[model samples]
Target: MELELKKLSPEDGRDVYDLLQALPADENGFMNPANGLSYDQYRDWLRFAAACLEQVGVVDGKVPETIFWLYEDGRPIGMGKVRHLMTEALLEKGGNIGYAILPSARGRGLGKKFLALLASESKQLHAGRLLLTIQNHNQPSIRVALANGGRIERVTADRHYIWIDP
Candidate 1:
């Protein structure tokens, strides 16, 4: 159950997209709430991911501080991201961390392992706590968060925001 995390590359875009497409219907795909993404929605998501990379100035031999890929047994299974506080809106609403495990990879402890790995990495980035926002209905994510020392910070109308402090 050892999972490896690697920095994402543009070459990985296709595999990531494919994994997202094959995500199981019961678990959250790229756009949580499961039911998976429509063909048009998937295209739009790819466009948006590309735009975000461009906006971060991380294209062409640059490393992104936020977005990264999560791999298991050399296969792409999910993505994890941590946005710095440079953007005030992200600090407040989006929080500092977010992750999505492909539905096909769920129930294998990959998500929990990813969360723990990121929480440990947060210390190097001067982050005392890692923030996670899960849809209220995502029981699996909530369990994963709690298993990784996440404590409930607040429960909004539609989401539960938890904090995993080091």
Candidate 2:
């Protein structure tokens, strides 16, 4: 199984669109920003995402973010995002990284692998530590985070604040 982690590209095709569409708009605490977008709308969203990744500096208090896709043998299997910088809002709830494996790709240790790949990508962007905020009930995600060397930094009424080192 040849696996690769690739940055999001506006030029990404229908396969990418299909993958995003497979995820629900909200799952546990993870949000699928691309859900419900029409094909053309999805492409437009990609353009916006690409710009966010390429922006040199934070604008209007919004930090830059880069999304990545995990591919296995050239087929997309997972997707994630790394926020280049953290704001108080991010620290509180947004987090520095968020990810989701294709529902059909769950189990088989893919979530752990995906998280690790995102961390590597974060390191490349000079993003220090990664903060992951998982809903309290999402044990699968919590395990994935822990397997990747994440430590529980805090706990809220409904969330687990984990920090994964770069």
Q: Kindly list the per-residue Cα lDDT of model 2 for residues 26-108, writing each as its tens digit.
A: 88767788999999999999999899988877799889988999998999988888998998888888799999999998999
Q: Can you tell me which runs of candidate 1 are displaced by over 4 Å?
A: 23-65, 86-88
Best model per lDDT: 2
Q: Output the lDDT of residue 12, model 2.
A: 98
What are the runs in model 2 whose C-alpha is more than 4 Å off?
none
lDDT, candidates in the order shown: 0.65, 0.90
Clashing pairs in 2: none
TM-scores, in order shown? 0.67, 0.96
Residue 130 of model 1 has an lDDT of: 72
State the weakest 10-residue window (summed lDDT) of model 2: 23-32
RMSD of candidate 1 to the truth, in angstroms, is 5.8
Model 2 compared with the native: what TM-score? 0.96
Candidate 1 per-residue lDDT, tens place, 1-166, comes to: 4477765454444566676666544434223321366656666655555455445433453323445668787788877766443344443455667677876677888888888877776676565667776778888888989999889988988678888885
TM-score of 1: 0.67
**Residue pairs in collision within model 1:** none
